[model samples]
Target: MYQNLDLFQTSGAMARHAGSRQAVVAQNIANADTPGFRALQVPSFSEAVKNSGVGAMKMTRSNHLHGDTKAAVVARVIESAAEPAPNGNSVSIEDEMLHSVEVTREHSRALAIYRHGLTVIRATLGR
Candidate 1:
C-alpha cells in the first residue's frame, strides 16, 4: 500500500534516526547531574542523507571492511560532552534543551513530508 511505502521506503530511515537523536538527548538530560556522565548527540539527518551519495559505490579498498560498500544512510552519535567540570558532570541544561527543540522540529517536518507523499500516492491510485 502507498502508506506502507511512505512509512517503510522513505520515512522509515529518517524516523529511525530521529528516534536515536531523541533518545540521546533524553539520556543527556536525565544524566545532567550525574558525575562523569558524558553527553552525546546524534548528527544531523541532512548530513547522513547527503553522504549516502548516489546509492551505488565502487569498493576500492584492498582489505575487507565490515560495512556496506555502497553508502547506506546511517546515524552516528558523537560525544558532545563539555570539557572537565570540577564535579565531573559536563551536561549543560541549556544546550540539551536547544538540541531537543531542533530534533523535535526536524522529526515533525519529516513526518509531514512523508504524510504528504502518501497522500499523493493514494490519490494517484484512486484509493
Candidate 2:
C-alpha cells in the first residue's frame, strides 16, 4: 500500500492539471463572443508527463529524445492574450471544446493507470 502511494500522488497531480486545463478551455469558450478576449490554450502536457519522472517506465525510442525538464513543466501556463482580434474577440468555441475533451480523456486515462497499479499491489499483498 505504501509503495503504491507514489503512483496515486502522481495521478492526483496529473488530474489536477487536467482539471485546470478544462477550466481554461471553458473560459476560452465562454469568452469567445466577448470583445477583446483572446483564446487561452493549455501548454504541452506530454512535457508534463515526462517531467513527472516516476522513472518506472521507459520509452523505446531509437534515437535519444531530449526529455523535458521538471522546471519546464512547472512553469505556469501564461496566457498570451495579445493576439490581434479583428472583432476584438479572439476566442474560438469549437477549438476550445475539442482541446478540453482531449485533456479530460488523458486525465481519465491517467487515473485508470493509477487504479490498476493499486489493484496489482493489493493482489500481491493477498488482500
Candidate 3:
C-alpha cells in the first residue's frame, strides 16, 4: 500500500509552495505602482515545513500521535522587508523578478523529485 508514501507527499507540498510563492510574486508585481502597497512574500518551503512541524514525528496509528495531525504546510503571505519608496510602495520589480526565478527553480526541483520517485517505484516493481 502506498498510503504512507512520504516522498510524493513532500514533492507535492514543495510544488504547492512554489506555486503559492509565484502567485505572491505576481501580486507584488501587479501592485508595484499602488501607493502604500507593501510587497508580499511567502516563507521558504523549508521554513514553512519546519514551522508546520512536519517530519517531527511519525504515527503508526490514529492514536499513536497525541499531537495535532491537522498541521498542514501552507504559504502564509507576509510583508516584505524592502524599504518603501517615496510613494509608500515597497514592491521592487527587480526583487520580484528574482523571486520569480527562485520559484521557477523550486517548482522544477519538485517535479524532478516526483519524477525520480516514480521511476524508482517503477523500477522496484520491475516495470
Highest TM-score scorer: 3
Screening candidate 2 with a backbone cut-off below 3 angstroms (N, C-alpha, C), the clashing residue pairs are 36-88
lDDT agreement of model 2 with the native: 0.68
Cα RMSD to the true fold for all candidates:
5.2, 6.6, 1.7
Please name the candidate that would achieve the greatest lDDT relative to the true structure.
3
| TM-score for each model | 0.76, 0.70, 0.91
Pairs of residues clashing in candidate 3 = none
Pairs that collide in candidate 1 are none
Per residue, candidate 1 scores C-alpha lDDT tens digits across 1-127 of 5544524455667777788899999999999889888889888888877877624444557575543455556787888847747887778888889988988887887788788887887898899
RMSD in Å for candidate 3, one decimal? Answer: 1.7
Best-to-worst lDDT order:
3, 1, 2
Clashes of 2: 1
Estimate, for each residue in 1-127, the C-alpha lDDT of model 2 and write its tens digit: 4534667766766777788788888888778878887677666466665755535343346464654323213424666454546887877666677787898797898789788987998899899
Number of backbone-clashing residue pairs for each candidate, in the order shown: 0, 1, 0
Output the better candidate (1/3) by lDDT.
3
For model 3, what is the error of residue 45's alpha carbon versus the real structure, in angstroms, after optimal superposition?
Answer: 0.4
From the highest TM-score down, the ranking of the candidates is 3, 1, 2
